[model samples]
Target: PTPAAPHREQAAWWAVVGWLGLLLQVLLRVIRGAPSSLAKLLRSLGLRHPLLSAAPAVAFVQLPSKAPADDLPPLSPPPGRLTVVLDLDETLVCAYESSSLPATVRTQAVEAGLHCFDMEGISSDKDAKGRQRVNHVTVFERPGLHEFLQKTSEFADLILFTAGLEGLSCRTFILLSIKSPVSN
Candidate 1:
């Protein structure tokens, strides 16, 4: 019986294909400047080989930029809560000063029924949210940050002054059970 040669050539070709695929994907990310399905797909493949893992060393995908939306529920802060203009980032949770909550925040907001911004940060300018103006922000809240939220909601209006994506922010706030009473 003829000896069967190991599938070395086939394996080598597959590796090459994988590498090219990874390279093209990297280019696409550079052009788009954000994470894409391909990256996640590759990660899910569960390949542990160094060759597969090191195919693309550079991460070109840019994290999606969070921005406010047009349909935000009209805000109605507490009538006499003392508009404190509290910060939601590191000032409270003490992390990136841009991420939201430590899961603790969610709990506190839920318990207190306190409203909070998911992605809060200073816009590039006051009019950044305008159609012609770009909404810009520089901070975010932390995860499990109910403890942090408890401190702020205790005494302030807690308006989110950020350029983050409104939907994302609202979703987080809602999940936290943060609700505002409609008041005059």
Candidate 2:
């Protein structure tokens, strides 16, 4: 056979595999009601209507049940100090854009020992015209935050977690560590 024939055969084989995969997916969707996204994708490809008519109905088999294990050991409390994971945004402190903060929050922030600093060199925030603007974040510590950290440190190791940007997290860590009396 010519080299072209082999290439054609391989292409035909892949086409068959692709169709089989599509058919199996269709069968699964029929067995379980199709998800909206999957239904949309099928419709977009013009395969939904044809597959619905051409595909064979698939039956799902029930899985065999297993006996519960009675020899498992009873759960025991942790041996050492418990670990406490705290979220940074609302739990330990609240960070806000300096320009939009309310008067009450600004006052409380002052009372709570707020940390205000300008963040430049990065364009994360957008202005009304959609141009990127540098961020100026003001972070306000929660009431009794220092005392809470001190007390918690005696019985537990605290971990600060945040969903904010990397720079914010680094700044938060540095600022809190500088203010915190607790030793590593």
Candidate 3:
């Protein structure tokens, strides 16, 4: 049996109302994307959005509003070679942080025949420490680190700086397969 015409009209009106509600939601999203809109909403709640506060300070990136340079000088060569410096501990080795040793480095060195060595003490072997000594040593490098070091060095100069023992740096780099750095 065909539905009554009045019922059909009522169903169409409900569908139209739902569509209007969806369009209104899209409009709300667009309006909310504006920083000012967010700021106003935040203010209404007795708060200031921190990002909005600092944005104006950096917003206008046009030429300096103040006086132009009084005189321009010819550019001079940079003082030294373009050197990239990297830290050995966190930057090169993966350490446990709170534990005595960064797990990965310690394990790698041991497997490579480093015996009676403690990660806390910067030692290549038991005899090197002379006795029970404790110092956090970055013994190995991060994974996939050799390829990165090689590729980077082949292009630009790289420097690996470490506060570890004088000789430790060499062994550490070797263990990590890091090539001789452009500069130490």
Winning model by lDDT: 2
Candidate 3 runs further than 4 Å off: 1-81, 95-140, 174-182
Q: Report the C-alpha displacement of residue 69, candidate 1, in angstroms.
A: 57
Score residue 159 of candidate 1 by CA lDDT: 56
Q: 79-124 in candidate 3: lDDT tens per residue?
A: 7545678787667665442355556756767687543222443544
RMSD of each: 26.1, 16.0, 17.1
Scanning candidate 3 in windows of ten residues, the lowest lDDT window is: 115-124
Candidate 2 root-mean-square deviation in Å: 16.0
Q: After superposition, how far is residue 176 of candidate 3 from its true place, in Å?
A: 4.4
- Report lDDT per candidate: 0.48, 0.71, 0.60
> Candidate 2 vs candidate 3: which has greater TM-score?
2
| lDDT over C-alpha atoms for residue 48 of model 1 | 49
- Report the C-alpha lDDT of model 1 over 1-184, residue by residue, as the tens digit: 3344457767888999999999977776553454456545666887443433435767697865764677468889767766555443344322223233366755665577543443433433446456433332222334435564566667654554423345434443454434332111
Error of 3 at 103 (Å): 8.2
